[model samples]
Target: MSRTLNLGILAHVDAGKTSLTERLLHTAGVIDELGSVDAGNTQTDSLALERQRGITIKSAVASFVVDDVVVNLIDTPGHPDFIAEVERVLDVLDGAVLVVSAVEGVQAQTRVLMRTLRRLEIPTVVFVNKMDRRGADGQRVARDVVEKLETDAPIYFGSAITGVGVDDLVAGVTSSLPSIDPVDGPLAGTVFKVERGRAGEKVALVRLFSGTVRVRDRVKIGDSAGKVTAIAVFEGGAAPRRATARAGQIAKLWGLDVRIGDTIGVAHRDRVRHFAPPTLETVVESHDRVALHAALEQLAEQDPLINLRLDGDDIVVSLYGEVQKEVLETTLALEYGVAVTFRETRTVRVERPQGVGEAVRFIGENPYAATIGLRVEPGPAVFRLEVELGSLPRAFFTATEEAVRGTLRADRVHDCTVTMTHSGYSSPVSVAGDFRGLAPIVLREALRRAGTATCEPMHRFRLEIPADVLTAVLAALSKVGGVPLTTTATVLEGFVPAARVHELRRRLPSLTRGEGVLESEFDHYA
Candidate 1:
């Protein structure tokens, strides 16, 4: 029997994720006629808002056969706001086709997405799409993928427009794809994404990591020990007759009361691998109060990474990036039958008072009190502090770590950069979560307030424009807070400028006139 591979097409918004989906479908002969994302006729992005906005708002799945292997393709939204959608979909994918624009190599959102993929350990291939577009360079993009994104991914050249490199990409996907081996001793699969199906039934799209599953098989999910009584295969839009599924197979199973990070499977009854959850949440503003909840719920159903919650009068949905706010508005108005407005998304941040000596008291009847004196200060943005006590008992250390992590999560400290160093240690354990729940309500909000000290996305922007536009282009950078870190000019040939920053928002597009191209990575924040 031929094996099936589940893959996702991921990129920054307008990086041709949907366009690549259209081309891949066409190449696989799933569609007789090709549809354009701009025109909104693509099979994956059939939603009306997707067509009108010419961008993918939710992750859409479509399947095709290539090299006798069934490839289940998930086209995910590239905008940061919909990052929750990407995060949820990545749970189901065994591999990904990371589409980077030839003119714009690795971008800000791309860097964040790549980090998430690495965390998940999902194998990936880089596709440099829009190669036929003016100034397109596949080699440059491939270099950016390796250097900036730190991905050892090989580039498969392809123009989704003219089918220039589509065949090679398809071949690489089929032949070079890596296999995800099942866990050593148990049946393990992760609940990457969850959605509400027809008539309020919850459907979980699970990627089994190992072992076999049969019809009527009983499986436990997450710590809640939610069980699934029925295992059903997904056949296009309908349920399949098959009663069993195996490792590497994507199955739609019912009876799983799953959240985005939950893991579900047999054998691994007590242990669950929790995927990263969304860090930001926002309310959906709509004129119809009743419809707002339903629309947000439907959107949440489509993308579980968007954790939707009703906190009293507020309807909150988790988000991954800022651009998602706009996408949410568009998706609500288009797909959910509600015209909506969005409150400016509040970014979760972390705050720690400087020079404050704080102590956490851990006292048990066992007469074990561990206290450590500490001072709080900012650390690097990405690394977290982890303490392993060799002298302490394993259970004590575990309990302390759990307590700290719990405090941090409840306090939303993960939203900011944290560094923990050893201060002097005493008998009483002073291990408690610190620096919780910061906020950045608008631009220019202090990086400290945002719980994120500014870390600018760096890009080696390759622009191919008329030579006459060079002066206007260079000047536009200053207006957008971009410093021309490096510029190489050639007469009549245009310019290739490389810029570095801690952040780029609204300025990159404004400087480029939506015509000049750019791509960037998260270079370390200075």
Candidate 2:
């Protein structure tokens, strides 16, 4: 067996994350020549849009050997808009290399990634890149990291471009970070990423935690089952053919239509938690509606969390910020050759149940062919389902439970995933067909009677500014309906609606003459 380590490279936009990846691979002799992000020739950034924009729109993986250990390196997008891509990849990482630009110091996205790394308890080594640039102060940046990120991370000063501290950074990774033993269990893995092969066959990038997976092995992803026809292991900037992949390794498996966050194997792990939900939504318009819909369906298969839905003649998409919107537009035209337009972004509305209520629909009602009795009430879980086992046959319980959980994501009230105490049915007779069809109507009525209200997600923010600018910052926060939780000479902590995050982020820099620092994370919904 080979010793292995899985790690990720994370940072803010243009902070030299891809640069660091290129330099590391070159130094390890994994690649023959160095590739530069500015020249659009980096090995990991193979996408055309990435080259055009000089930003990583998707996460890419590469592998190299260090000190007899096969190290799998995941380079993640640095933009806040694509943070979801980073969140999904977090499950596979044993540790991470957080790159901070010595010239720019600690940034908002840097702070966000640090908070997540800490929350996940993934050990990290901070690398201060771009030290050769004028005004680059590795010491000041290290101090900022400790102060803003609140982490006692071991910091290494170096420039990924100049190879000043590249060797030291590699040594730190191999020596300082301990290896993670594979969890003992059956063949269980999480599908963190997915893509389509050249032949249009579905390929799932899975992080296997236990058991050995070989070609032709039968694997189960959620309720779907398929036999793996091929396997690819990330090595030396390429995914080469592999016969088998064991626990603690990341591999690509074919023949399974697995979505991101799907559990492949016995026990299931919850989807990686994200601090903020998408607050912006846009309607997709295209001259060729049919082709555009098909294109979106394909995109949805790649990133299931986007939750792309079709509404009659229109298709609506959830967005993190403006960058995502631009990327989607460019990708559609570039990848699928589908020219599309988008409507002005609108705030995505979520629904919450106000009180308790129940609804019943029997056979021969409207177009229904089954009976469903559901009682819905507000509670903690996103959508909890309970059934009276005595009322239904044991054989049908499994199917019914799956259907209920599937429908929980979308309720009729506001088309949002609603939190509820319970939505259940009791029947002495088993329905002829699946209850999934009837459950939606019953659930919708129950939620309607429960008194649904539109709710928006909220965020808690911290702003650091000059002492003299504190009063102006307070006024700006007040204008955005922010409630301050704490106020000091130069810092203000408060909670505000997520809808106003972009405004605060945009205005603060101008208000404080580019000296203000703002950090925000999801708090709750209001």
Per residue, candidate 2 scores C-alpha lDDT tens digits across 99-207 of 9999999998898889889998899999999999999997898889888889998899888888999999999998888665656678988888889999988899988
Top lDDT: which candidate number? 2
Instruction: Write down the lDDT of every candidate, Cα atoms only.
Output: 0.61, 0.81
- Which residue runs of candidate 1 sit more than 4 Å off their true CA positions? 111-121, 138-152, 180-185, 226-241, 266-323, 330-340, 344-347, 351-526
Worst ten in a row by lDDT for model 1 = 435-444
RMSD after Cα superposition, model 2: 3.2
Tens digits of per-residue lDDT, candidate 1, 28-102, equal 777889998777788888667778878787677777776557777888888755665676676677788888999
Give model 2's clash tally. Answer: 0
TM-score of each: 0.63, 0.91
